[model samples]
Target: MSANPLLAADCQDGCFFVDGRFVPADTTRDVTEPATGQRLGRCAIAGAEAMRSAIAGASAAQAAWAATPPRERAAVLLRAAQALQSHFDEGALAIARETGGIVPKGQHEMREAVVICQIAAGLPLQAQGQVLPSTPGRLSLATRVPHGVVGVISPFNFPLILGIRAVAPALALGNAVVLKPDPRTPVSGGTIMAEAFARAGLPAGLLQVLPGDAEAGEALVTDPRVPMIAFTGSPAVGRRIGELAGRHLKKVSLELGGANNLVVLDDADPDAAASAIAFGAWFHQGQICMASNRVLVHEAIAGAIRERLVGKATHLPVGDGASGQVALGPMIDARQLQRFDQIVKDTVEQGARLEAGGTHEGLCYKPTVLSGVKPGMRAFDEEPFGPLVNLVTFRSDEEAVTLANQSQGGLAAAVIGRDVARALAIGRRLNAGMVHINDQTVNDECTNPFGGPGLGGNGSAVGGPADIDEYTRWQWVTVKDAPPAFPF
Candidate 1:
C-alpha cells in the first residue's frame, strides 16, 4: 500500500495558546504518521508554567463569558459551526494527515465537528431554568450555572469531533475551557478548533489549546483552578483521572473503553445483519468505542453469518486513507498495532479459530474474524480496539442475552431479530447505555443519550439536550412574598 500524501509531509511547528495569545512551548515533539512511520509535524509540548498560564487564562475569561446572555452564547456557537464548515476541506486534510483517518472518515469527522458546534450553540436556550408552581404569591425557580473553568482531555481517535464536542458545550454554557489535545493528532485538531472559536468572536482567553503527552494531561486534571475535567480515552487513563478528580473533589465526565457486542438471532434477515455488523466492526479499523467487537448469533444461523462475515472481511479494501474504496485504515500508532497483534495472538492461543485475513503491513492489520471463541478468551472479556471480531453461538434467547451481558464493559450493544417483542425484551435486558434493535450500534441524529455503564467509564452520555445539562450545574431559588410573618 502506498503512503498517504498528507502523512508524508514535512513537520510544521506550532505553539500553545495562553491568555488569548499563541505562546511557544518550552519543548517540541515530533509527530509521525503511523501508516508509514514518517514524520508529519512537530507540536509544542506544554510544561508546568504553560499549564498554569492556561488555567489562569481560562479563569480570567470565564466570568465575562458566563455573564453573556444565553442567546448570545448560543449565537457564538452557531457562528463557530459556520466557520468550521467554511474551512472543512483544510481541516479534513489536516485530520487525515495527523490522525491517519482515511480521507473520507476524516472528512466525515470534520463535518461532525461543525455539526457539534451548531448543536452546542443551542445550549444557551436549552439551559433555561425550570419554573415550579409556588403556593400563593411565592415563586420557585431552578437555573443552570457554569462551573467556572473546565479542563478537557481528548483522545487521538476522532480527535476533531470528540474534542470539539466537549469544549463547545462547555464554552456555550459560559465556562472558560482549557483543552489538552491528544498529542498524536494535536496539530490538526487543536489548531482548527482554536481558529474556529476565534473566528466566531469568542472572547480572547475563553478557549485555549495546549498540546503534550501524559504529564501535561496529569497537570490539567490535578490543577486546583480547574473545577471540572472531561476526558475520553482508555480505561486505565480514565481510572487515573477519576482517582485524581475524586481526591480534589472536582467534577468529571469520563468517556472510556468498551468491548461492544452485536446479537443476531436466527429469525432476522441474515444479509442485513451481516452487512451492519461488518460496517460496525471494520469502520475506522474498529477503533471506535461503540464498534461491534463481538458477534453473538443463534446456532442455527451462525454458520451463514460467519461465512458472510468472512467473505466481507476478506475483501475489504485496505490501502492509503486517501483511497475512496478503502474501508479499513491503519491503527493510530505502532503501539496500538502492537497491542492489537498481541490480543489476536492471545485469542488464538486460547482456542479461537482464525477465519479470515490476519495479514499485517506496517500499521495496518487485516480485518480478521475468529470463531469458536468462548467466555474464557481475553477477546471475549476485554475491549479489543482493533478490527478483530470474535464469534460466539447461542442456543436460545436467554442464553444470547446472558452471553452479551457477560462482559464487564457496557458501552453499547445491538440485537437483530424479526420479532420486535423479542428484540425489545433483549434490548431491555442488555446492560449497555445505548441499545440498537434490528441495526448496528452506531450513533445517529444526536438526539439520544449515548454513554456507557460499569467500566465503560463515561459519567454522562454525549447526545441530545441532556449533554448541555452535563456541562452545567443547577441551582434552586425561591422568592418569598414577604420577610416571613415569624420574624424570630
Candidate 2:
C-alpha cells in the first residue's frame, strides 16, 4: 500500500506569528477536516491587541528592510521559496485537513508558491525607475519606493497563494507586510507561510500572519499605519474596502470574484473542448474565481460538445479530497454545499436540463453539467462555485460574444476554435482581464499582472512586475547646483 501522505500535527490550539515569534492568542477556533469531520488543529483568532501589536511591529521594521540591498532582499525570498518546497508535504497535509483539498492539489500549490517566490526575488532588478531629460545643469528623475507597510487580506479558497501574492511582493519591494488569511484555513494560509519566511531568515517583524474573522479584516483595512492594501475576495467586500480605502486616500489592489465564461466555436474540436471544460469547471469543486460559469457553444455544435463533456465529467474521479486520489472534494462547509444545492434546484425548477450529475452525497457534490439553461434563472448567472456548470447555445458569432460578455464579470475568459486568428480577434472584443485564444477560461502565471475588470477587480493586477506598482509608489526628484531666476 502507498504510504499515508498525512501526519498528525501539533498546532497547540492557536498562536499568532508576531515579529518572528509565535505568540499565543487569548482564544482559538477548531479547524476540522472537512472530508472526514476529524479535528485537525486550532487557529489563533487575533484580537484587537494582537492586531495592534502586529501593525506596530511591521511599522517598526519597515525602514530598515527598505534600506537593505535589493539583492539581499531577493536572496531571502529565493530561500523562502525553497523552504516551501522542503516543507511541501507538511503544508499539503495541513491544507487537506483544513480545506479538503487533495494532496496533489496541495503539491501544485507548493510548486506554484515556489515559482512566485522566485519571481518576487527578481523584482529588485525589474522594479527600476526612469530618468528624464532636463535643461541647464538640472537633473530630473522618477524613482520607485516602498509604501512603508502593506496590509494583505486573502480568502480561504486559495489561502497560501493569495497570502503570498501580496506578501511576497511587499517584501520584495522592501515593505513590511501584515497578512490576514481567512479564519477557516489558518494553518495552510497563515502559519505555513510565516514559518517558511522565518526559516528563510527574514528579519523580525518583516512579515506577520494573523488569522481572524471579518472584523479583523476591517481593522486591517482601517488601520492608518498601513498605506496600501492588497485584497482578493468577493465584489461586495471589494467595494466596501475600496470605499474605506478611498476615504483614507490609501493605495489598494483588489482581485475580486468573477463569473468566468468560455466561448466554443463550431470549428473547435469537440473532444478537446470537452476535456478542457471538465477540468476547468470541476477543478477545486468550482471554488476558483476563474472557474467556468458558462460554456457558450455555437448551436450547430452544441449537441456534440454536450455529449462529450458529459462523458468526460462522468469518468473523472470523485472521492475523499483529503486522500489525494480524488479530483472532486467536499464543499468547504455545510453552507457552501447548501448554497450549491439551492442553485441547482432552482435552475432545474426553472426548466434547465440536468445533463449528468447534480446529486450530492454528503458534502462531495458529483461533477454537474446542465444544458438549455437560460437567463433569468438564478443559476444561469450565479457563480456555480461548486463542481457545477451550465451550457447555453448561441446561433451566431455575435450572439456568442453577447452571451460571453453579458455575464456580470470580466475576470478570466476563453475562446476555442480551429481558426486561431478569428478566435484572437473575438477575444479582443471581449471585456476581461485575461483572455485565452485556444485554451480554457482558467489560467494564471507567476509573471504578469493577472487581475480582472468590471466587478472582478479594482483595475489592478496582483502578480508579476505589476505587483511593485500595487505595493509601492513613485516619487520624482530634481537637483540643481543653483536655483534658476523666475521670469516676472
Which lDDT values do the candidates have, in the order given? 0.82, 0.84
Q: Which residue ranges in model 1 land beyond 4 Å of their true spot?
A: 1-12, 133-137, 480-488
Tell me each candidate's TM-score: 0.94, 0.95
lDDT of 1 by residue, 1-488 (tens): 12222222232355776666566666988888866677876788887778887888789889998999888989889988887777777678677767777888888887888788888877778636889887877789987888899999988888887788788888988899999988888766687787777778898999989987778888888899998998888888998999999999998888886768799989988889889988888888888888897899899998999999999988888766755557777889878888888888899999999999777898888999999989979888888888887899999999988898887767888999999898989889988888888888766555666678876775477666667667888888999868767857
* Candidate 2 residue lDDT tens string, 1-488: 11322222454248888989787788889887778887777788987667877999999999999999998999999999988887787777677667777777777777788889999998887836888888869889899999998999888887888889789988999899999888888877888788789878999999988988877877888889999999988888899999999988888898987678788999999989888888778888888888888888888889999999788678777768877678887878888889898999899999999988888777888889899988787777777788877898999888887877776666888999999998888888887888988888778887868888877888788887687788789999999998889998
466 Cα displacement, candidate 1 (Å):
1.3
Where is model 1 poorest over a 10-residue stretch in terms of lDDT?
Answer: 1-10
lDDT of 1 at 465: 66
TM accuracy, model 1:
0.94
